[model samples]
Target: MSKYHSFNSEKNIKYKLPNEITLFWNKGLFDSFIGIDKVNIHYAQFIQEQVECPTIVIVPGRCESYLKYQELSFDLYQQGYNIFIIDHRGQGLSGRMLLNVNKGYVTKFQDYVDDLRYFIENIVTPKSSEKPYLLAHSMGGTIATRFMQDSPNAIKAAVISSPMLGFYSGLLPKSIAKILVAIKLKFNNIISNTPWYFLGQKDYSPVNFTDNKLTHSIPRYQYFVDLYKKNKIIQLGGVTTHWLAQSIAAQKELFSKIVQLKTPILLLQASGDTVVCQQAQDDFCQQLHTLQPQSCPNGVPSNIDNAFHELFFETDDLRNKAITQSLAWFEQHT
Candidate 1:
C-alpha cells in the first residue's frame, strides 16, 4: 500500500462563487479521508433514487479537483446515474507535497493506479450497490488508460475524453529527455517549469464561466487561485523531469500492451485539441484495430470535430455532441 498523509490544519479556507453562477442544489456532502498512503482523498456524492443504477466515477484532468466537476455530476445525475468523483492525490484538496517537492508530481504512474484502486474498493463500490463505469478527461484519461491496462476487469466500461496518449508539443528524442530527467530526479526528485502562463491571465480568470465559457464555473477554481496566490505550493507547472521520464516509460508500456486489454473502451478524440498530438490518438486506435479487430469492426476511428481538448466542456453545441455520443456509446455497451 502507498503512504497516506493527514492534514490537521484548521485554516479557514473559504470559497466564493461568482454572483452570476447558480447553485446546483442536490443532497450532497463534501467528504474526505486518508487513502493509499493516507493522502487526503476528497470527494463529493449526489444521491437520489436508491435503485441499482450504474455508478459513474469521474477522474478529472491535472490541476482539477472534484469540486471543479460539480456541473458534470449534475448532468450525470439527471441521466439517472449515481455520481462519484475524486481529487487525485497531488491535485485538488488532497495531500500536498508528498515528497520534499511541489504538489502534482508522482514518481510512478502506478501511484495513481494504486490511489484509484483504493478509491474504488473503499469508496465507490461500498457506497451504492451498482456496477461502476469510468469517465476521465485529459491527464485523468492517461491515468484511466494506465488503470485499464493493469485491471481490465475493474470497470464495466470507460470513456476517455481527449486522452493524453501524447502531448502536442513537438517530440524530443526520447533518450535525451529521459537522460535529463534521470539526472534531475537523482538530486531534487521534483522539478517544474514555470506555471502554464495562460493560467494567470486576467481575461482567463478561472471563475469566469458564463454560457460562452470554455469550462464549467466552480467556486473551487477561485479558491484554488487564492490558494496558489498565497501558498504557491498548489500551482502545478509543466511535467517535471522525473515525471517526464516515468510518463514516457508508462506511455510506451501502455501503447505496446493496450491491445491486450479486453475492457470495453470509448476513445473520444477532440479535433481542435491543441494539447495532445492527433497522431498519438491515431496510433492508439490503429493498435487496437490490429489487436482487437472485433472492437473496431468498421475499420474506422470514432472521432468528434469542432472541439478543443476539453470536449465535454467546449462550446454548448460541441459539449452536447460529446455528451450525446459518449452516453450513447455507454448505453450500447452497458
Candidate 2:
C-alpha cells in the first residue's frame, strides 16, 4: 500500500517470521533491515496470543547486542509484556563499520534517535498498535532519555537502569573533553582508537559473566565470543572524541528538560555502579521531584543497592532484584 512496501517488494525484502524462540521470548515477528542511512538495523517483536498486553522495548548499553538480553526478554515475557529490541547501527549482527569508522561511533546522537524512530514507526507500531514501554540500560538510557524528550507521547512509560547521565570516572574536565573531541571530529571521522579498558580484565569476558548460571554453564558465552571473533568489525573498541561530543550534547539536552517530560519515568540508578556517576542520578531525581510532580509524585526516587553499571548482568540476587523492581515500577505506572 505504501511506497516503502513496494520498494521492499522490489528488493525481495520480505519480513521473516520468527520461530518459537520469538514467541517464547515475546520478540516481535520481524527480522533485520537496512535503514535510510544504508546501515543494517536488526529488530524483533512479540505479540500476546490472548489478552492484549502492554509492550516493552528493551535497549541495551554499549557493546551489547540482542543475544545478551534473551534473559531479560524471557523475564518480561513471563510477566505478560510483549518485547521489541533492536541492535544499534554498526553493533551486534547489524551492519559493520561505515566510512572506516568503528561500530558504535556516531557523528550525532540524533542518529540513534532516528534509528529508534524508524523501528517504532515501521516495526513496533505496525505489529502491536499499542502504546509501548521503554526499558533502557546505561548508554541506552542516555539515548532513551533523549528520545523521550524529543517525542513525549511516543511511549507511555520508561524505566532507565543505571543511566549514563555522567560517568563515575574523573578523568578530564568536561569542557576540555568536549573541545578535544570536537577537534578530533574535525580532523578525522575516526578517532579514539584505544581498546576499552574493561576488555583487558581477565574476568570480564562475557562468557564468564552471565546472570543465569545454568545458561552460562552451557558454553553460551562462546557463541557470542565466536560471533565477535569472526566479525572483528563489529567489535567497537572505545568511544571517540566525536562520540563523546555527541554524548555530551545528548546529556545536556536530557538534563535541560528532564522534568518537563510528560511520559512517566522510572529512573533506576545502581548504588554500586562504578561507571555512571550516582550523584547525577540523585540530582536528576531531585529535579524531577520539583518540576514534574505528576511523573514522580512520591518525591522519593526508586533506586537499587549493590548493583553495578550493568545491573541486568549482575549476579542472580542483584539481577533478580533489578528485574523485580523494574517490573514493579512498570506495573505501578502501566
Candidate 3:
C-alpha cells in the first residue's frame, strides 16, 4: 500500500482553499467517435503537499459540469486524495452538439466512454498517481460502469452513487418507454443525431425546492440552482430521445459485463432515491457476488438509508457519511 497521509477532519473541517489545492484545465481533445469531431473537455485537479497521493477522478452526471463539484473536490482533497474532475463533451464549457445548447445530446453511449477514455489516456493517467479511484454519480455512474467493463484497469476502485443502471421512467413502464423510443429512432431522420426532446421535457427550467428530489439541504440545493441561473454555459436541460435510447442500451451492456469486471466497484445506493431504479442495483450487485464470490462475498452495494439521489449533493450529515464510507471502501480495495 502507498503511504497515504490521512487528513485530520476535526482540524480541516473549515473549508479553506489551501495553497496545496491548485486547479488546472485541459482543452482541444480531438475525438474521432462520430465523423472526426474535435470535442473540447475541461478538467481540474487539486494537488496536495505529498510527493505521491492517491487520486480520485470526479465524473459529473447529466446536465452537470465540473463547476458544481468544487466543494466535493475540496473535501476529498482534505481527505488526502488528489482530485481530477472533467466536464464531458456536450456539457460544461465543452462544445454543444445542437443549436439548442440545453438539449442533452450524444451520438451514442460509446461516444461518452470514448471521450472519457481520451481524457484519461491523454490527460489524467499521465500525471495522476499509479492507482486512481472513480467517483461518479447518476448518468456519470452509468458511463463509468461501461468504462470499467471495457477498461477494468482504469481505476483501482469506483464509487457509483445512485447509478443510472436503469432510470426511473416516472409513470411509464421501463420496457414500454424503451420500445417507444426505439420506434421513434427509426422514422426520425435526426432521431439518432440531432433530435426532438423527450416527452414533457424542454430547455432549462429551474425546479422549485418543493418538487426537488436532490437534497434535503435548502442551501445546497439553491446553490446549484443559483449556479445554473448564473452560468448558462454550464446549464444543460432535459434529455433528447437519442440520449435516452443510448442510455438505455449502454445500461443493458453494462449489467451484461458487470460480473466480468475485476475492479472493486461499490454501488452507493440511496434508500430514498426516486431518480434511479434500486431493484436494478440489487440485481446487479447480487449477480456480481454470485459470479465473483471471492472479491464480492456479500456484494459491493452499500445502502445509505437517509440519503437521496444525489448523495454528494445532499445535506452535510448525509454527504459526510457517504464520503466517509466511499473513502473507506476505496482504501480497503487499495
TM-score, one value per model:
0.76, 0.77, 0.87
With candidate 1 superimposed using the best TM-score fit, by how many Å does residue 100's alpha carbon deviate from the native? 7.8
Identify the candidate with maximal lDDT: 3
Predicted candidate 2, C-alpha RMSD: 9.7
Tens digit per residue, CA lDDT, model 3, 169-250: 7789988988888877664655344588877789989999889988886777777788788898998889887788888889
* CA error at residue 316 for candidate 1, angstroms: 0.5
Candidate with top TM-score is 3
- lDDT string for model 1 (1-334, tens) is 0111111111221364332222443467678878665667787766657678888889888767675565457667767778888877776677754443343466477777777887777888887675588899888888888887777778887788887787565466546655655676555534343321121222112334343223332333345455455654345554555555566677778887786577667778877677676778788777776776644335334677666677765544566667776676667677
> How well does candidate 3 match the true structure, expressed as C-alpha RMSD?
4.5
Better of 1 and 3 by lDDT: 3
The better candidate by lDDT, 1 or 2, is 2
Worst 10 residues of 2 by lDDT: 4-13
Give the runs in model 1 whose Cα sits over 4 Å from its true position.
1-26, 98-103, 171-235, 293-301
**Candidate 3 lDDT (Cα, 0 to 1):** 0.76
